[model samples]
Target: MVNSDSPTTPLDSPLARKNPLTMENFHKFEKASNGTTDSMTAPSATISSTSFNSASLECASKETSTIQNETLKKRRNSAGHKKDYNQTLFENIDYLGCSKLNDPSNEPEMLDLMRVLDEQRMTSAVTVSLAVPHSARGFVVLRDTTGIELTSFPVQRIRFCVRGRLDSAQKHCFSISFTHHGINGEQTHQCHVFRSAQPEMAGRALYCFSQAFSNSGKENMSDNEKRIDYKFEAYLEIRENEGSQSSPHWVLCPQQNNTLKLRRDRQKRLIVQLKQVQLCKVFGPPLTVTKCFGMLLAAGRNLRHSDMQLLELESMGPGANPSVYVINAIWDPRIHVFDVLNTETPRDSRVFLTVAADVIIAEAGEPIRFRLEAKARVFHRDERFYKLPRVALREGYSLTLEV
Candidate 1:
């Protein structure tokens, strides 16, 4: 009521008191201050965002550094484990100890010990005394455990000396027998006497001595001869065969004896001499023979030496090959007579005779005939006879007998 009665005061009125320009200035000032405050706060907010992004980057960098340190530590540990394995592998290898024992730097000491051992082991003493009027050659007697005895003929003059030891002391009581084969094929007489020990005892002693000799360098004669003046050895291999009723046999001096001595029951011995006997021969203009059924015969009617103008002879046993028979005879137009000479026979004379062809006869229509000229020569001719049978001659030919 007071405002309505008082004048229309502009300050009191709501519409009159508000100046448009002042209000507009106030609104503009308020907007400008608000804009300035917002600008200042926006910068602070951007600083906070930048600070948060920098903190995140620092955390990432710290994590990466820790991972790198762990990776580097792991790489260093793997290299140390491999070096310790190789040091323990090669510990025991000795090459120097083996070479020193094999060398013969002390051969004399070894020989002395061997001699002492040999004398102590002798079971008996054997002596042989022989008296000769002239210089005699040396001989060897081979004996074995089975009572096998072999006597070798006197060889050419050989320089040798006797060595013996008894009870650890060198003894000179042993003797050797001697014989001489005169140079002149004349009859020679000499009485050489030697004292011999008991047969069984001497055999045992000799066996022991032979063993010592074999052990002391005689095992390799070729190498031992260079250092020592004498080397003698003997070896006995006693093989028990199921079929043998007696003691083991001995094969002594294979080259010299070329025989096998088999012990049989009742002190009997079987001497199997490796003697070769001639088997056969074929001859015409040339000689040719077939080795069939351990027998010698012409291969065929047309397989004559005259047909091929060549001679071939073969062994009937294992590894049979054709061989040429050499003859000492002149070939004549009338008759090619071959003189069966000693030179024509093999030097060994051990071949078994199966067949022989002295001459070959051939006609156009008649069967060929091979004639025997001589008896087959063989080793131990006194023990065996190889006579050509009359039936062995061809149909029309006859054999000329030679006494």
Candidate 2:
């Protein structure tokens, strides 16, 4: 047991009086300077008091001043979080998304995509990681699962071929063929393919990338830079004869029979041409022609599936029937024909014609005119066209339009 009435140490003497480390006294310099005058305010325990060292008191005062300065700084910056200067550039921005293919049997690679809108251009960057083995001579293998060569560019001079299709193996995938220019003026082409689970998002991705690329060069240009402001409009009227009120008539031009010849050029490329028409309507045969409201054009390379070709064309609402229909042309693999089918059922009509032929569009007139042979076949959904009769024509064909 300890004695209750013993003399205290120097630490106990300081605790009996006011503590100098308290924030009230530490906040004011005058309280520490006038310590002798304020000593009377302290507890009257001088009978058993021990003196504190002058050097220790001075060191304590310096530490209190340093802590107070830090507290003042904290109060001044209470608005928001401070930016981290130690972080890298990529870490500073928000990461958008990435696309990768990791089949061990195939060429394994990953593509990290990043996008940002700057004052001048919309910038897109891709970081690629390849898992190819290096040879004894220190050359990395550059091959892909699809047997296409894979190459890359450091920063600039990258020309890309971006394609979005719903009928790909991954269903809604982007095939980006990147052409990288070498330092010696030689070009190397590499392809990176990625698929998105959200199929419609593939089109959105292409739109964003196109918008960014278009704005890259003309950031500083003004709207007033245009040299001309041109505008014009026109109308047309098709007149009918007095005796032809009971039956429907072919608008603008009459129906006539024509032939399509499919042949190959010297390079073995497909060349599809149509035979000329007489441009007259005859009344004897009572030829059945349904007024088709719209036409869709599509193209495909794979012939395994019948509906795969339709995936190439984005849906266009029913068009005005027999009006001159125009379709955009595709550059790759080249398209030769456009098929016009009667999607309507017999509950709607009977013996409707399905035409497959090449059309020459005349855009110079008031209303457009699609010039082609009027000959077409009566299509049946249940009936297979494994063979064509002497008078019957082939059915079901379309082509994809170019961007």
Model-by-model lDDT, in order? Answer: 0.21, 0.23
> On residues 189-284, what C-alpha lDDT tens digit does candidate 2 reach at each position?
333433334545444434333332333222223333322221111111111221233553412211223321121110111111221222333211
Worst 10 residues of 1 by lDDT: 55-64
Q: Write the residue-wise lDDT of candidate 1 on 288-339 in tens digits.
A: 3222211122212333444322223222222222232122111111112212
Instruction: Tell me how candidate 1 scores on lDDT.
Output: 0.21
Please report the candidate that would top lDDT against the real structure.
2
The residue-level lDDT of candidate 2 at 134 comes to 13
Q: With candidate 1 superimposed using the best TM-score fit, by how many Å does residue 335's alpha carbon deviate from the native?
A: 21
Best by TM-score: 2
Q: Candidate 2 at residue 259, lDDT? A: 24
> What's the TM-score of every candidate structure?
0.13, 0.18
Candidate 1's displacement at residue 105, Å, is 4.6
